[model samples]
Target: MSKLSPGEVERLKNSLKEKGYKLTPQRRAIVDIIIRNEGSHLTTEELYDLVKKDCPEIGLATVYRTIQLLEDLGVICKLDLDDGCGRYELVHQEENHQHHHLICKNCGKVLEVQADLLEGLENEIESKYDFKITNHSLKFYGICSECKNIKNK
Candidate 1:
């Protein structure tokens, strides 16, 4: 994914504005951090600590608020990953966000793979069954590479 341009940020602000979500200082700062750091599947508390470097007065509640606002605006995607806490990541417009996760049950490592890997099966399922397919999310659970090796040793 590409780094966000100034134009994109402005567009996002305008988009949220229409939704009645004011681009407050805390919200912008939080969004800016997420944009600047790509590929960060961060938790709310982690984002709060990082955002504190720029705005120490920011509260955890504020972070949570911003995250929800962003998600509502389709600016970011939230993933549960079947973990204890939810994680957040900036959603790329180029990608359809149609993918599955490979999660290591032992160590909780989650990696995303494009949904195309299941293209034939998805198509077959739709043809053989009676369901309109709009979108889907799949998650495979297993032990991670390191954990597998550890067991062998």
Candidate 2:
């Protein structure tokens, strides 16, 4: 079941309205899937397939358009995990920046690091370089503990 609340849906509706768009049924299904699989980092094709199960008559082009619309509205963001595929994840409203990702090299699993571990570094760089950092994306790749444990066994 989706963790999306009614308030969140209303907020999304308001966002779309502000952008001269509407939350159609197909679009709602896509958004529902995205919310349900919050950390899945689904690709456009993966999202399309999942939406097809719910909206059998939906077209790929419509999915693409909705993705573009949502992205333009800053409701989602694209991530590159160096896997030759672009993945999409929601831009959490409460987060000042997107959380970092830890990708397991062996099992190809991705874990989210909720801690903002780069504040000091970002501050140092901003002061030294006279730059104002607005946002950043970081990905760390390594073998996860589960993989290491399996290897030891």
Candidate 3:
């Protein structure tokens, strides 16, 4: 899925309610920013900064707590984008599937791509060891074009 649709958000809220988790304002704001910054791979601190722009009264403690709760509810996925920041993104129901991020070491930029391209390895693992694949993360580290040109001088 591209991002959480209005229907998806309402469905998520209802699901969370069923699981005994309420979608309070704090949680809503936190999730909204995560969805807006879909591919940005934002850390909780970064998320808090974004939220504070709209809800100045939101505390970092609350952001932290809400992030954990939302994560537990499967509305988003926590990512260690290999940039020293634990980031997150909304779990888009229509998207291909969860994937890993590629980080530009010199620029600290993040790019998300599908993990399906690794089917060869996935099959190898299953065939060789009967490991029945479920999921995995693969991060690549490199200097992006801009950084490469800057350092070439």
What is candidate 3's lDDT per residue for 1-153, written digit by digit as tens?
A: 255678988988898889887888878888778877778778889999999999999999999988887788778888876556788887766644577677798778777766458879888999999898766778888878788888998
Each model's TM-score, in the order given? 0.81, 0.93, 0.86
Candidate number with greatest lDDT: 2
Report residue 1 deviation for candidate 1 (angstroms). Answer: 9.0
Candidate 1: where is the Cα deviation over 4 Å?
A: 128-130
Write the residue-wise lDDT of candidate 2 on 1-153 in tens digits: 446577877888999999898999999999988988989999999999999999999999999999989888888899999999989998877888889999999999999999989999999999999999999999999999999999999
TM-score of 2: 0.93
Q: Sorted by lDDT, highest first, which candidate order results?
A: 2, 3, 1
Which wins on TM-score, candidate 2 or candidate 3? 2
Q: Evaluate model 1: give its lDDT.
A: 0.80
CA lDDT, every model vs. true structure: 0.80, 0.91, 0.81
| Of 1 and 3, the candidate ranking higher by lDDT | 3
Task: Identify the runs in model 3 with alpha carbons over 4 angstroms from their true place.
Answer: 1-3, 95-97
lDDT comparing candidate 3 with the true structure? 0.81
Q: How far is candidate 1 from the true structure (C-alpha RMSD, Å)?
A: 2.5
Every candidate's CA RMSD: 2.5, 1.4, 2.2
The better-scoring model by TM-score among 1 and 2 is 2
